[model samples]
Target chain A: MAIIFSSLNIAFSQNNDQGQLSGNFSVDAQVYKEDLDIGAEVPVEKMGLNSYANFLYTRGNFTAGIRYEGYMNAMLGFDSRYDGVGIPYRFITYRNDNLEITVGNFYEQFGSGLIFRSYEDKSLGIDNAIDGLRIKLNPYKGVYLKGFTGKQRSFFDFGPGIVRGMDGELFINEIFETLNNAKSQFILGGSFVSKYQKDEHVTLNLPENIGAFAGRFTFMRGGFNLSGEYAYKYADPHPDDPSGLYNYNTKFGDVILLNTTYSAKGLGVYLSVKRVDNMSFRSDINATLNDLQINYIPGITKTHTYSLASMYPYASQPNGEIGLQAEVIYNFSKGTALGGKYGTNVSVNFSRVNSLEVKPTANLDRFETEYFAIGDELYFQDFNIKVHKKINSKWKADVSYLNIIYNKDVIQGLAGYGTIYSNVGIVDVTYKLKPRHTLRMEVQALFTKQDHGDWSMGLLEYTIAPKWFINVSDQYNHGNSEKKNHYYNIAAGYKKGANRIQLGYGRQRAGIVCVGGICRNVPASSGFNISITSSF
Target chain B: MKKFIVVILFLSIGISLFSQSKNVPNVHIKNLNGEIVNAPDLFDGESLVILSFWATWCKPCIKELDAYNENIVDWAEETGVKLFAISVDNARSMSRVAPFVNGRGWENLDFYLDANEDFKRAMNVINVPHTLLLDGNGKILWQHTSYAEGDEYELYEAIKEQSAK
Candidate 1:
């Protein structure tokens, strides 16, 4: 390592400039000593390391770069495919005259990324880089066209399926000469993506072609702006559906999002709704659990900051679900009764999702019928609300309440488990000391007779200026039918200039980590974690 | 009059070509000192510059950087080379870059940042550590998507060959 660093220094120093060359790298190493078996089934590990690096150089309209990744001992709950090191991306790209081309691994997103999204989430160990060719063309002002054909990455390797897609977008202001000066502007876009994989008498015969398409429209006029997209997909079957009821066929689904915000003076309000079906967009036709993910689903439940409130975060069920979210942000005008001296900011948001009602026909063989009949029953639902108020310059407070209904059987594919209903409440307060110091406290409680039982949580955080912070939190399962479990953690961090270090010791419960709607399971563990970062 | 015509034709062609190139938006990135810097200014215009994002714990990243280090001087002499090593370590583990670099004795790399990932999102960087190559004109030239063992040699050859042209 020392020799490598010296060589790098010499390389950078000597190549001061001919064209540009720069790169960055990082490594995360952890030592884990597993305790007695709890709910976890995987073997306990002693240590693990996850690291990767990227290098790039460009001159003129041409650019070249590559990435290296290694996972010596994969993390718990993560797949082992990433344990090997190799080059995941290698390609040269050029852009000139409104045309851009890339040949190699690339990430892209169309619209809300609901149906077609090729992206990477390093923290969650998710990557779906497409190894192929991509092209973007802007034929005229405001008109954009994009197309790509590639195979998705599976760990250090590529998946068997081939993906091809095309999308077109038209910006109204630029496309319609007459609309350039209009008070209201509009933009529209549409996309279609298809995946092909050969099948050979697997458990079942799956469709070789699976396709998804979406159309989006956005209108902006004064204080009112609305954007929405409708996406649909053909039937796609998986090996998990033993009943063969949810077999791959030409399945139809759509996600409609309508966001309208009125911001005038100091008040704002927004509303959105989405419905999705069989939309678990992934790269590997067979990749499961922290592997080969290609798209994201939007979660309807609020992402709570408190431990207990976050314990049961709703992971979007891609196969079938409808969700709605609404939020209002209102700021009291200065000198108003509720505004106080500095004015007051108030916000409230709520969302819920449920499985589509499907009715199944009897007498038909279980394997021959559909997984769900039309007009059945709801799968899940959640309602939440929050209020935030600043009492004074030194103090601020927020309170929230949530009610949720989760179907453990459907969401987790676990047998013998029924639906769960839970109610959760949280309150947070922050106090300011002088100019650079602050302290925050959070208290939360969750009541449920469903999965995991009732729980309570508390967290405290203290920060001093730009360099130091300390946080402590605890979650206690007080109403469990089995033995009550208490989870606690304490962490502190210090930073000086570009360098920062953090130390943490804690006992944590397993939970789900989700982005957009994709998710990965985090295992329960108790240990010490130290992290150091610097640049220069 | 003929000379004037020729100049006009040349200017028009230059303008047309410039218009054809995609405009890369400028982004603000934090330096090792936590100070913000414009990305484009990192290149001094005299030599070919390579910008890479990496971390100490990443094995492949280490291998790639080490490979480049071995032949970087030769590549530099053959075609003026400059390299910037940007670390995307988040707030929790960002302090280790300098020490790690010192430990590795990488004398040729300068450090940059995407601490809050503002630069990453702007550049649409989805995976790490990813690399981006830029030309002296501050225009993105060629970007190899990812790296393998002998990939650095290929990169060096490309740089050398391009600079010579």
Candidate 2:
């Protein structure tokens, strides 16, 4: 721990030119003690810590960087595979004129990331960087090409399977001399990705090579824009489906996505539709959580912020589902009827997803589903509306309402538990009495007769200038009747320049913590958490 | 472990021997129009530039930018400072950024999208509402993370100092 701090101190102080050396460090640790009342049990290590520091040095057209991660027996919900620590990420690259190359680890993403995406998310405990070689070539002005081949990272070791991918994109408008100033622009691209593994099964004969291909396009005009992508994968076998509907033989998979948007001065509208079937592609056939993922199908639902409103976030149904999302936003100009001294903002969003209609096959290992038809079983649905208004120069208010339906049977992997229909309402306001001091208040309520019944919550936060902030909040499951639990917490923090330290103590009720569309269930516990962050 | 310490000391000494230059990274970001644009080229090269990394899911990030928009027209005249609210929302939530900003009528500030987080990672930004102040020469003057009610004043002060110089 001391050595880690020393390296951070050195990194934070050394920022200069002629090959600049700079980086950032973040460390999160907690002290956990057994709490019988809160169902918090003691772990082998009483103190758990997660720390990371990144150092980057760049000179002229050359760059090098390394990241050190240490998870001393990761936290409660995190996977134990991250028990040890080492330099998991290191890369060196050079870029000049029309060509560039990287010889170590790097993150890359293709169109919509449907066929290939390599990234790292510390919060979600995901890091699947490719360790081999990658190259990019701009042979022409409007043409871009990339190619790479490597093995995926699984925890501290590399996976057995090897991956190879290639992508090429062209800007039609830029490539053609006659259409330099065309009103509508066009961009086209294509990708091919393949993974290789040895056939080791005695009873089943598996293919040594599995491949996926994708083609995408984009068209943009003055105020209208549209983009779409279609991907198809060859037969591959895997057995980690939460649905538990098909588990034997492998079958082909496919995904289709299309989105369009239009915006004016004070109004904007957007809509997108997606359909996926057996699209869980990974390097390792049986990997779970966020390991060895070869593609990412972004969720099509609006991400809510308020606690109650976001209680049931929709994770993308990668296996098989069809979903549609639409949103409209309008702003009334100042000095108008709806817009008073300032203005009024209103937004409405709607989304729905359902399972695929599949017909049973002879072997029961593969299934068939149509491309366009909607299924009967509902996977998730959300409809929400929000309005914001400024009452005066010192006061502002916002109100929101959300209605959501979550299929617990599929989302939470609960066999017979049924769907959860919840309605959330929130009221948030801020008041300023002094030049550098302000008080904000938030009150929210979740109404439902299923699951844990009704829940009510409120929070108060006060801030002073640019240095200090204090917040306290509590949520009560009032309608449970059996166990009306009160999850209470208080936190205080101080900030200056690029440094911040926060101390929090609370009873963490059993729930889920999500980041970047990934979810992790956290067990209930009572303890103290300290976080320190600094960058130079 | 001993060799690690030795390497660290040598690196520090090497870093101290060289001086710094005034150049910001030439990263690319997508605008609301879905067109890729060089980050440092967004400004006209003669004034202070503010990069306020934000997200659609963060509440305070939205508030601080709203405050900047409220007094921006007048503030721009008083001090030649510009603000670009870079949304670090991925594809999962990036599509809504355009509508959200337009819905709020925050058209004064340029709303750029870092859909892939390429620029965010280039700046070593771990969280949203992280603000950076750059000079006319493209060198970062100062930066701060998180936000409070009066945080804007500190930014204004920094801009004032640069203009005075």
Q: In candidate 1 chain A, what residue range of length 10 has the lowest lDDT sum?
A: A363-372
lDDT of 1 at B92: 20
Give each model a TM-score: 0.72, 0.93
lDDT of 2 at B92: 74
Stretches off by above 4 angstroms in model 2 are A1-17, A241-243, B1-22, B43-46
Q: What proportion of the true contacts does each candidate reproduce? A: 0.00, 0.59
Please report the candidate that would top DockQ against the real structure.
Answer: 2
Candidate 1 per-residue lDDT over residues B114-159, each given as its tens digit: 5545356434454454555667744444444333334565466568
| Candidate 2 displacement at residue A190 in angstroms | 1.6
- Cα error, candidate 2, residue B13 (Å): 15
Task: Give the Cα error of residue B57 in candidate 2, in Å.
Answer: 1.8
**B-chain TM-score of model 2:** 0.83
Model 1: per-residue Cα lDDT over A1-536, one tens digit each: 54454345434641323224545455666566555533533344566667766766544567677877877777665676777688887777786657879899777767666667676677667788789999988799878788999998888888888888999888788778898788887778899998888876456666788788889887767756677778777656554464654544334555555555454445555566666666666555676654555555656554454566666666777667776766665666457898776555555667766666644556332222233333244566667666556677788777778887777776666778888889989988878775557788889999998787999999998877446789899888988888688788899887543345678887767877654455677788666766654322
**Candidate 1 - chain A - TM:** 0.88
Interface RMSD of each: 18.2, 4.4
